[model samples]
Target: MKVLLYAEATRLISKSGIGTAYRHQIEALSRVGVDFTQDWEDVYDIAHVNTVGPGAKNVVRHCKNKGIPVIWHVHTTPEDIKNSFVFSNFYAKLSRRSLTRKYAQADHLIFPTQYTESVIRRHGVKVPGTVISNGVDTQIFRQNLCKAREFRERFSLNGPIVLGVGFPFKRKGIQDFVEVASKMKDVTFIWFGAKILALLPKDIRRILRDPPQNMIFPGFIPQEELIGAYSAADIFFFPSYEENEGIVVLEALSCECPVVVRDIPVYKGWLENGVNCLKGRSNDEFEQIIRTLLKDRDLSEKIATNGRMVALERDLSVIGDSLLKTYEAVLGRCRS
Candidate 1:
């Protein structure tokens, strides 16, 4: 069946996790031979909108009026948006009310994680919902020895590397990353993502300007380069306070890199503290976990191997099959 897939501010979201998710979903759908269009005006069986913006709301309204089933992919909520960037907390307050109204227009709602589904439900979203991971392309993100070597030589990196991928935002635990870096001078910490320095809060800007010597901000690298970074790194450390689903974690896991993430509820079933990956609830715990991983090769390898298995389970091919089922289920419900 043909579908209309729309995401508002696609250009602006290209550097964000939401953009990566949208691209992965599109790729998965195509792999399953699902006919879809990005054009809002295109005639289709389903309208899958990925944002809660005015344009997306309008599309949902139009689809509802036309007797078309609409799938609203919930990518962001007010809680996750708070403290993300300058003045985001203020916008988050307004976003909560706006999301409630927009979500009501959907025939079905899709959440990347069960935690997100609960969050939306708590916000009074009464629509039927399901959880589906925004899966990873394992082929593109897998380990490559040659690319890893190239990345090390290009950056003149030495010692065990610790990598974090995402925009430099406060809610992403940028401050905690920097603090951890200061205590570990021997380790090279690289944060691979884009950030608008001017738009960041003054305190955050100050820290970014005079970051720890061990910390390197390689703003927005290409996919090939990113895969190399993931492969080359000894540990992937993500301390982000919020996430619908940490897609980059899956990418790192796909590359067979052991990860240490903040002990957040979003990773409840997806990540285990000592099974697939380590979890740290504080700066001290994070530092200790990283050190333990660096010193113990066996433990690191074991976790990395398990993590890769988890990634494989959520690979795009599998996700494609699940998505098709969800779509077909939605269509069946519409018919009934």
Candidate 2:
């Protein structure tokens, strides 16, 4: 099928999960040899969009004018707007609401998670939508590409490493991540996140400005180098307060790294605590669990093995078929 996929920023090609998802979806279609473009004369059969802003809005208008099918992939929620955009700019939530109306008007709705579907549903903007969990390149990430000792020396990493990923923002519960790092004395805490300087409160900004001796912040790493980062860590730690299916969790699992994720509903569905992954709800629990996992190498390895198995079966090629089915369903509905 012909598709015109539009996104907010292709910069996500180098950083962050939403950008990563956009890149993956386009790549998946490209691998299957689908036609897509901006212009209408050579016209697209479907126009797939991501975030609800200038690009998505403009793409939808163009596609609708040409009588082509349109799909709005809802990757961000209302809460993300409050956290990422200031009051002045967050007025786009109103525009975002209008975009949800576009979803209601579109030939189809594409969402990364059911949680996202539920959010838009609650907003009284109901239309046909399907859930496609974010994807991972399982085969590429499963192997250990970097030698541990030399890699550790290059980055000056010391002790059992605990990694904190996702953008550094309040919604990511970064303060909670910092609290976890502060409590753990022996482990070196590492953060690979975006620089959200303007959004943070003053003290939180200063505390993270220099970062502590124990805390390591690698500003931004491209998608190509992320596997090396995962290979370097003993466990991937994420405690996001708000996540519509954390794709980084899948990426970490793809690397055969054990994970400690928040006990959020979306994560709870895929990750079985203490069996396939470790999960926590409270700060005390998050700390104790991290310490216990650090000491238990055998348990961690077993969990990592299970997590890799899960990522392969759930997040890779299997998801491609599921996505295809969703597209087919949308097309079928449109025919009626």
Candidate 3:
């Protein structure tokens, strides 16, 4: 079938989750020889608009006018706005509410994870959407990465490394990470994303105690460098208070890195608790959980194997098929 993907927000700074997701999905479809177009030159049977904000709304409306089935990929909600330091509160709220309406009216509403689906159902909208989890490039984050050890040494680490990515601040649960890291003095913690740096001024940064001696601050690195970083990380410690569904988690899991995620339905169910990840509710919980994984090499390796297997099963190739199925189903529904 013919499809036109309007990835309007792909221009954001590198490592931006939404932009990365859009770009990767577009590439995934192309790799598999899906007959899709980015521009509007050819008439498309379906128009998948990635994102929920104003930009996507316009594209959805245009497709609706042309009688093409529109797929609205709702990645975030109003709660995300409250929790996001990367995007200003005013903009997120405005975008969330409007996007909700646009999504509710679209031919199909698709979410990256079941957690997002569950929350939106409570908002009193009867939208027909499926929980299609986002996928990762398995080749880059796989257990077979040749540079794993070399990359670790390059990052100046021979010890267990705790990697934290995405925006910083209360929303991302970095504050909790700081509090937790201060107690467990063994593993090294590192952060990325320029937006995280921009969140805290020099004065605010000074107050936070310097992390463990094992810790290192290797400023923001480009997306291309993330494979090396993932290869080196001993654990992907994500304390995000609200992640629509962390793409990084998939990336890390693909690299066979065990994850310690907060008590969120998406990660909790999507990933087998204690099998692929350690699920927790608070800073103390996460700290203890990390401690368990760190001490148990057998457990860590087992979980890592499970994580890579999960990534292989849920690779972009698989996720793309689900997306197309939704598109075809929606198209048939529209035709009838």
Candidate 4:
């Protein structure tokens, strides 16, 4: 069936997780051979709205008036937005009320993770919802020795590389990553994303100003380069405080790179510490995990293999069927 897939501020967020998710949705729909359009004015069967911006609210209302079923994908919640950007906590306070009203307008809601679904539910969003992952395209993100070698040479990077991907937001644990990097001076640490200097808080700006000699903030890279980076990294050390579903994590896992993430509620059921990947609560814990994986070849290989399997399950090809079903179910309910 035909669908209208829309996301506001695509240019602004194209390097962020939300934009990655929007791209994944488009890829997933296309893989399932579902006809879709990005334009809101286009004639379509359903409207799948990804952003919570003013234009998004307008699109949802327009769809509703036309009796078109609208799927609101909850990419950002009030709690997740609090520690991000300058004055973000204040924005979060305003967003709670705004999100509650905007979310209520949808025919159904789509959450990237169960943790996110629960968070919005606590905010009193009673709209029926389903947990659908922001899946990865395994074909593009898989392991590649040639690309990995090229990435290291291009960046002038050496062995035992530790990598983190995403914007330098406080909520993403950039401070913690830097602190952990400081403790490990021998190994090279690279963070592959950037944010406007003016938008970041003073503390974050200060840290970025004088990062450890071993640590490198190379700013955002293209997807092809990112896939190479993931393939080259020895450990995908993401110390994020919160995430609906981290697309970078999936990309790392898909590349068969072992990961070390913070012990957060968002990874509760899926990420078991010492199983598919390691989890740390503090900088000390994160540093220790990285050292262990670096020295212990068996442990690293096991986690990498297991993590790749996990990514395969959430691959775009598999996720496409789920999206097709969800779309059909929503349309069927509307018909009944």
Worst 10 residues of 3 by lDDT: 201-210
Better of 3 and 4 by lDDT: 4
Estimate the lDDT of model 4.
0.91
lDDT of 3 by residue, 66-155 (tens): 888877777668777664554557677676556557768777788888778877877766778888777888876675455667667677
Shift in Å, residue 29, candidate 1 = 0.9
What is the Cα-based TM-score of model 2? 0.90
Instruction: Put the candidates in lDDT order, highest first.
Output: 4, 1, 3, 2
Q: Candidate 2: lDDT of 264?
A: 79
The lDDT per prediction is 0.91, 0.74, 0.75, 0.91
Off by more than 4 A, model 2:
12-14, 38-42, 85-96, 145-147
Worst 10 residues of 2 by lDDT: 80-89
Error of 3 at 275 (Å): 1.5
Tens-digit lDDT track of model 1 for 177-211: 99999999999999988869877899888987888
Residue 308 displacement in candidate 4 (angstroms): 0.7
Q: Give the clashing pairs for model 4.
A: none
